[model samples]
Target: MAGLRVDFGLLLEPLGFIKVLEWIFSIFVFATCGSFQGETTLVVSCKGVVNKTVTAAFAYPFRLNTVAFSAPDPEGCGGAWTDIYLVGNFSSSAQFFVTLAVLVFLYCIAALGVYIGYKHVYQQNSKFPLTDLAITVITAFLWMVGTFAWAKALANIKMATGASMIPGIETCKAPGITCRLASVTSMKTLNVSVVFGLLNMILWAGNIWFIYKDTNLFNKSNIISQSPAMYSARRI
Candidate 1:
């Protein structure tokens, strides 16, 4: 009779795919200026509560304060030499990049752990026992936290700034600016981010279960090897 064969591919393949997904989404999150060569639909539309006036404040890349000529004011001030960006814009932009860095770091560590698992390499180092389990657990926890904060982190700004799921006619918001949006706006980044966050939760959950199974398999194999040795000693 033929014996069964064990292949670690079942475990590693999914992890690889997960890494790919995370990498792609990380680009969207880290795209501070725009996704396509300095072009994006991300902007703030502000409306005055009293005057019902609107202003369109476009998003710019993160940078230190620079003294520059004022942009032509919507109030028709013909532009002035003033500081750029509002309070909300700077805060949100900074946070998005920070979150991107954290997620990318976690994803890299997870990739390394997956490599060690499939290759069965460096597994004997007791310096840090069960490193794979640690990686899986930490990654899952981070994913959980990220998903929980999905609303506040990514959704709030997109939604607040006139993000629409409908095919036509989108809107955006800012403190005192509003305008009729004519550009074909897109929210691909926010959509992908939400989807990625959900999948990450499921994949990490499966990873934890797989690690438990692997550990038991290892213990059983060790016992099976010792059984033949003990029998031979008795026969001697």
Candidate 2:
């Protein structure tokens, strides 16, 4: 009689799809700036907050009240009297890039761990190390989503200050201003971050399970060490 053959494709399909999803989402995250629309809506709809109201106040007496201004206010405006710097609210392209870079690095490590675990199981034609598998998958998901959040936050800043479409809008015209100047406008990012944090917690839980197995079960038991006997026992 012919022996049965296992379908490795069935087992590996999901992992491959997840990897592809990561790549697609990464391009969107990195390129789209997270699609953040500016707070012009809020500042316009809400009372008491108009053009010059959202100022970027710098250290000691330097302050740029609006994007229209080319220089800071006169209050001891610091000597030099050189080039003027405009101040405007803009998105966080640099921060988004940095955060996304870190996220990608972490996920690459997680993916490598998963690949190693899968290889170990397949080489012996044995069951996968479920704990390791879960940990790596969960870590990848969290890191991916977190990177998305940071990207969107920066995109939002771009949206708000009308910098999402740069060059058309003057760059560095806004002085001493970094991306994301308002908190009310970042609620979407905050929600995404919360979900990402929860996923991270789940990843940590999986790591704990792995530690428990290594410390209390793997070291003391002869499960894998006597695999042939164990398999025979299962047949009877």
Candidate 3:
């Protein structure tokens, strides 16, 4: 017959909270990118010496598909444009996939850990595994890579759009219409995506710290329990 079970508080630690937060951030970044459909438009104005004026338009739109994607920013004047927006869109899509992988891993590990801990709490001699620490380290690196990709994408978009907006003087390529950029505007979810991405990166750093601290405390307790003095003290 078994007596009262020992107080294995480690099995009831707050590690699950971090796991929950991890999933939340991952889903948040994904959703922000998904529901976001943004476009950039540049309106060009041209004036002829005969007191007549004409206008041209250039638009860059982003599109994503479940099986494939493309980056197209065509101009009305048939001139090829910069590919910054393309790169930015690709980066966002990649980040979404990476975040999804991380979310799945977090859910699995958290569930397994909770289940194992629950079983151990009943004195079944079960033990928590160190796999989570490795997972954290791996995901941290992935997060970093994803973060860099996002930064590059955003930078490229800004540069491309700004450069394209500078519609310098142009001769009448078309019969009587000369065109120059009048105004440029971008409407996209890049702002929200960027904000969420930054916060996600910061949260990842915190998660690493929390895991280190918790594991350190756990290891120290084990070491103390194995100490000769402590064992003797317990005997007395």
Candidate 4:
């Protein structure tokens, strides 16, 4: 039988509090992309006293929109009003999809870890069950998987948007309206949230599993007194 050498000096109190907070944070980030939804200007052109503006709106008030505008250069409008056109719009679905996948994975694992922690702490059963250990291990595995997915997503976005510069797209003339696309490939704020939240969740799951496995062994050894001696023990 495996047993934890309990040190009366060591406190096991509030075993599940940190996990609960991590779970809540992960869920909030997964469900909301509030910062990503807004109007963003991508490209601009200035020529022949003309200026053009391109804007991209994301997760907007429903139905993303991109608009282009061309106006005579404020300084000097002449020579056929060199009209310059700019183009910009919400990033491709591929970008958003990858992000969403990572967020979902983190959310699920964090929530599970928090729940398990709460159960283990409140119940305070000397012999934690195998089911509890299994749950913790599974959640930890998921956090690892989420981390890999997040890396892939970041790589894909970098390749697709490449420093926010449009590939093969030529710059617009100062006076003419030339179309250019702006890249909205990454959300730095959300990325931080995902990374930190996953790290905390994964660690929490590992801790629970470590404790649970030891407890299970103790139970098997009959070291834990689950019931009162009068009812559960046989007198020799």
Best-fitting candidate, measured by lDDT?
3
Q: What tens digits encode model 3's per-residue C-alpha lDDT throughout 1-236?
A: 13433343543455555565566666666565544444333333223132222322222223211211121223423442222221224545445544554574566465545544453432232233345556667766767666666656655655544445334323324344443333334525555556656666666566666565545456677787789887798999
The number of the candidate with the highest TM-score is: 3
Clashes of each: 12, 11, 0, 15
Model 2, range 179-224, lDDT digits (tens) per residue?
2223233335434433444444344434444434433345446667
In candidate 1, clashing pairs total 12
For all candidates in order, the CA lDDT equals 0.45, 0.39, 0.48, 0.45
Report the Cα lDDT for candidate 2.
Answer: 0.39
Off by over 4 Å in 4: 1-14, 31-35, 38-40, 46-49, 59-128, 158-163, 170-186, 210-215, 218-236
Taking the tens digit of each residue's C-alpha lDDT, what string does model 4 give over 1-236? Answer: 23333232212333344444545555554444334443334454445422344543444212222332233245423443332222333244324433543554565464444344344442355434455455566656655565555445545433334334344334343335344555454567546645654664566565674446446565655654655564655653
TM-score of 2: 0.32
The model with the greater lDDT, 1 or 4, is: 1
Question: Which residue segments of model 1 deviate by more than 4 Å?
Answer: 1-129, 163-184, 216-236
Can you rank all candidates by lDDT, best first?
A: 3, 1, 4, 2
Order of quality (TM-score): 3, 4, 1, 2
Model 2 residue 139 distance off true place after TM-score fit, in angstroms: 3.5
